[model samples]
Target: MAVLEATNPAFEQFVRDTVLNMPAARHLGFEFGRIAPGDVEIIQPYREELTQHDGFVQGGVLGSLADFAAGCAAGTLLPPGWVNMTIDYTVKILAPAKGEKLVARGRVVKAGPVMTVAAADVYSADGAEETLCATAFVTMRNIRAARS
Candidate 1:
């Protein structure tokens, strides 16, 4: 991903604060590791409660992590008072999610006033090894603050 700066100077703080306020993120124990313009990373520790009967991390948890990372990357390009929400999302689960933790890195491919496209790669990290577990492509629409 090309390094870019957000048009809104306070975007970094906004993104961080937004993530802190997201109930899904909080419930999933997602940690925002990096938040750069057009790029973001979210990490979550593996927990038995988040696993399925097969002992693999549930797909829903992975999907939520990817969506949050992708949406934040897209939001970095939006103006202040404007937010981006995912309109379309597609994910491909590549491998079993068996690891000590999960990390997702998302990057914005295209950012426009109306829509943005981003992709996230989810990895399963076990000790010192990290394996690709899933990939997601997300499209988001910008939402401006409503006029009173």
Candidate 2:
């Protein structure tokens, strides 16, 4: 993927602050890995609470991580006073998510004034080994941020 320039100059810092403070991301144990324009990475360590009965990570958790990463990637292109929200997200689980940690990497595929398309790949990382666990596609809609 070609490196895309960021429309928002403070996008990396913005993502760091916004994602770290998000309640759902925090509760789900998501930690920001890399935050750059049109690219984002999130990591979550395996925890019992985030697993299914078979000792694998829950699908919902992977979906949430993908959605979050994709949304953040799209946000980098938004103009000031604008925010993006996920309009559609689909995830395909390719493997059993058994690992010490899961890493989700997302990049914006296309960006426009009102809409953006992003894709993410989730991997299960156990020590030096990594496996593709899921792939996701997300569509985001840009809207004016509501004033508090």
**Candidate 1: regions farther than 4 A off:** 146-148
Tell me the TM-score of model 2: 0.95
After the best TM-score superposition of candidate 2, give how far the Cα of residue 26 lies from its true spot, in angstroms: 1.6
lDDT of 1: 0.88
Residue 19 of model 2 has an lDDT of: 72
Clashing pairs in 1: none
Model 1, 31-140: lDDT tens per residue? 88888999999888989999998889999878887888899999888898898888999999999898889999998989999999999999999888999999999999
lDDT of 1 at 72: 91
Tell me, by lDDT, which candidate is best. Answer: 2
Q: Backbone clashes in each candidate structure, one number apiece?
A: 0, 0
Q: Taking the tens digit of each residue's C-alpha lDDT, what string does model 2 give over 24-116?
A: 878997888888889999999999999998899999998998998898888887776788888999999999898999999999999989899
